[model samples]
Target: MILEEKKKKDEKNEKLQTDLCECYLLLNMWISSELLSICVPCLLKAASKKEESEDTRKEVEMALLALCNLRFIKIEQELYLNEIKEIIQHHQEYHNLTRLAYQSAWRFLVSRLWDDNSLEKVIVVEQHFAREAARELEELSKSVDWKKNKKGGERKEKEEMITTLRWMQTLSFFFGNCYLWNEEYVELFSSIVGVLRASRDNYREISEKCIYPFEEASGRRVVKIGSLWQSGAVDVALEEIHKSAKDDEIAAKILKFFMNVSRRLKEKKKDEIEEMKRKELKRKIFEKMEEEGYEDVVTSFHKTFDFLSNKYFFDDALSLDIFDYLVNV
Candidate 1:
């Protein structure tokens, strides 16, 4: 009886695997039909991890590889994009993308979506992916050995660090494409700030490799303006200031982030919730700056860059009530 049951189970497993392979083969052949729309969601779900088994991971790898080669028209993609978003956002595990296939699948999907010009359609998708990326960033930050310099790090450690940096670059690209206005986006940028705060030894690398690209891609307008404040980015900035006072470039970049936040806030039509959030953010910033003696850091940054080109930059930032409160107090 035991042998008969085992045989039945093995047959069932074999049939399921064969079915999955055939589905992948059909998808690879570019069969753009209603049938594919059904298959695509199934593939996404199959790729999503639910257990720790090696067999499960192998299934995920195979599904993602098939997804990497997915070819759908704009209309077909539009129809099932929400399904894709749901599967990717809620079903997939953030820490399980250790395989090259997982990375390639995401890269492929994002790049394909990059061609999409329907801002109305893609913004929500981008926001969901951004949150996922933020989760990934948080995981990477925790995994890193922040105390070690790059020269002293092991090869594996360095590879992980590089992966984290590349992830930041990816976020920069996403921010460029999507409007960064949601409160959830605050979580995303906050994660970026968190990573920057933790990786103290890689300050220059983060700035040059990550921050500069992010700044260029996002500009000042895409950000929701002061959303960072609601996400407690002020605290992260203060923490960095306390630890790395001598790194004026990074200090300047931090100030620029706040400045951009304040500057953009001034441009927005004030809703009551936003106004309330702004006041709260301003109060917290002032309290933390005072408690941490960050006034000196700002003073030092101002003195160093008290250049003619930055006169208007400081003026614009201070024009906001938040920066004005900081200055007067």
Candidate 2:
């Protein structure tokens, strides 16, 4: 009797796996379809409503998350150059979807964006996504068991962790992409620092192996920027500052650092001396940002920046205020 019951349970588990696989296939097809925005809510409902094993439930959730990410990326690609205000207006209606999508899409977009140097879109995409991934990982760490488990337990946990790490590596790729474009990808640079600081030993090791090239590329750019600034290239400095400011806190700190360094350079009359001081300062600032994980604050700034830059400032500002309060606490 016991043997028969075990056999029946095994069959049920196999069926659950089959169902989850079907859902994932459907999701992948839906992502590339015009019906993605429409199909997503239905999938989310199904994922929530379905009676399945833990593995099956997680698979469904992952599918839903991936679809959500694809939809947001589509929207981002369409509105990449539009005013922040316009993006926010459309984003408000889709905020729930955006949050869900960020879990999967942010990492994927960062990975893809980093690899393609031909695309001249904003570099902040990588920073935003990486920061979000780090945040999610941090939350996951707070809940999950990191130690080895018995039998099927360890495999299941490892699968989930691997999925999460894949997303992190994706974010790292975009960080590299930012450096590829102008080397002034300070937001990307800062985000990479943040992720490295927040990540566990295994995640850190993997990210370094996969994503360190972009960091190297950005380092080269920083050198060029320093040289230009020494040659009285205030305009170049300002441009770099603007691009970096896309990260809000990083921007503010970089601007302040630049102002101080430029002042010292003028007084010292030695470009090499000024460069040394500035490099040290840059290192310290990046370390501080990484240790504090201030990249997470950029999301709130994005909403506000979008609001202030738009015509519907009042409405958007109020909505963002509510969002900030909820997210920060």
- Among the numbered candidates, top lDDT falls to 1
* Among all candidates shown, the one with the greatest TM-score: 1
Candidate 1 local lDDT, residue 97: 46
Off by over 4 Å in 2: 1-101, 111-127, 147-154, 158-160, 180-273, 278-329
TM-score of each: 0.54, 0.36
Residue 232 in model 2: lDDT: 29
Q: Which 10-residue span in candidate 1 carries the lowest summed lDDT?
A: 320-329
> Tens digit of lDDT per residue, candidate 1, span 146-239?
7765575543436466667667655655665654355567777777777776665654565334453334333546564456555555666666
lDDT of 2 by residue, 1-329 (tens): 22232247434443344344435544463343334333333334433323436664465456545443442234333323232222223333344323333444344334334335434344343334333444555554544454333455434334445554555455444443554343343333444343433443334333333233232232333234343333322222232233333433334333333333333333332579766775664454445443544445444345455433353222222333323321120
Error of 1 at 169 (Å): 1.0
Off by over 4 Å in 1: 1-115, 147-157, 201-222, 241-249, 265-274, 290-295, 303-329
**What does candidate 2 score on TM?**
0.36
lDDT on C-alpha atoms for all candidate structures: 0.55, 0.39
